[model samples]
Target: MKPTLLAVAHGTRSAAGQRQIRDLVAAVARRRPELDVRLSYVDVQQPRIGDVVPAVRDAVVVPLLLSAGYHVRVDIANAVEGTGIPVTGTLGPDEVLLRSLTRNLPAADAVVLAAAGSSDPAWRESTHEMASKLQAHVAYASGSAPKVADVVADLRRRGARRIAIAAYLLADGLFYRTLHRAGADSVTPPLCLDPTVAGLVLRRYESALLTTAAGRL
Candidate 1:
């Protein structure tokens, strides 16, 4: 039997955010109907990682997070420890994500790649790397330096006539909403329900399964 694909996400209170996540998972399920795809959360919602992991006997935990921060390294790791259910890497710092961002990005003289920031340096570095790839400035909605609003203001001061914000988020939520008020001329929607996103999830799952099988051999 194929191992259950446990797609875990950072939950949100926004109804639209919730729907986007569900739709992303559903897209994955549709692509691979034989695989049992399940959805759960890391925070702010029901059937959290801790509760969901224990119930699945044979499964792989695929984090829906964009970066490897506390949630991926600490929260999800703690939940799946000793379960032998390997967890895949976060879904960012990849070409797939870059493609998703650019596809929806608005035209502008300057663009700020906005993310729901993290205290972890690794997470910050990953966001920066993605920003660099897009030739865009890096800004955080929370947690760390150079906030979205501040970046927008700075860009405007520096003579960027039309500034846009490329939201490096998984779904529409509090952070995405905040980007609008960041003083940018435009803000791209969050990354979810995109076919590339679903494809990336499957790639992570396949990569982890291969690694697990190789370890046994």
Candidate 2:
């Protein structure tokens, strides 16, 4: 039997943001109808990872986050520690995300990839790498320096009249509202609604499955 797939995320209070997360998980279910799928959050919501992981006998935890951070390294690790479950890597820095970004990128003289900043250098580095892949500037939505508004202003001063924002967010909420007000001419929607994102989740789950199988063998 395939292990249960627990789709974990950093929950939000915004109703729309909640719906986006649920819809994304629904999409994942559509991809593999036979798989038992579940949802939980690491923070700001109910059914927290600690509460959910212990209830499952065998499962693969796939983080819905796009980058690595304290949530991935500490919170999640602790949740599955004594449970002997395999936690898949966060869903990011992958070609699937790159495709979603490229397709959503608007026509502009310059583009800034706006991510939720992290204190972890590795987390920040992942966003920088994505920026490099898109040949775009990097800025933070919050929690770090070089805010999106500042990046947009710098682009304008540098003769970039048409600046776009590629919102590197998984769902809409406080961050998307802030990003839209960052003075960019255009801001693409969050990655949660992208069709490719669902596929990426499945790929991550499958990879974890393979790893689990290999360990058993």
Error of 1 at 132 (Å): 0.7
Q: For residues 85-170, what per-residue lDDT tens digits would candidate 1 score against the true structure?
A: 99998898899999888988888999999999888989998998999999999999987888999999998999999998999999
Give TM-scores for every candidate, taking all chains together and pairing residue i with residue i. Answer: 0.97, 0.97
State the TM-score for model 2: 0.97
Question: Residues 102-196, candidate 2, lDDT per residue (tens digit)?
Answer: 89887899999999888898899999999999999999989898999999999999999899998899998898889989999999888999988
lDDT for position 149 in model 2:
99
Candidate 1 positional error at 96, Å: 0.6
Deviation from native of the Cα of residue 5 in model 2, angstroms = 0.2
Off by over 4 Å in 2: none
Q: Which ten residues in a row are the worst by lDDT in model 2?
A: 1-10
Q: What is the C-alpha RMSD of each candidate to the true structure, in Å?
A: 1.0, 1.1
What residue pairs clash in candidate 1, if any at all?
none
Clashes of each: 0, 0
Give candidate 1's error at residue 155 in angstroms. 0.7
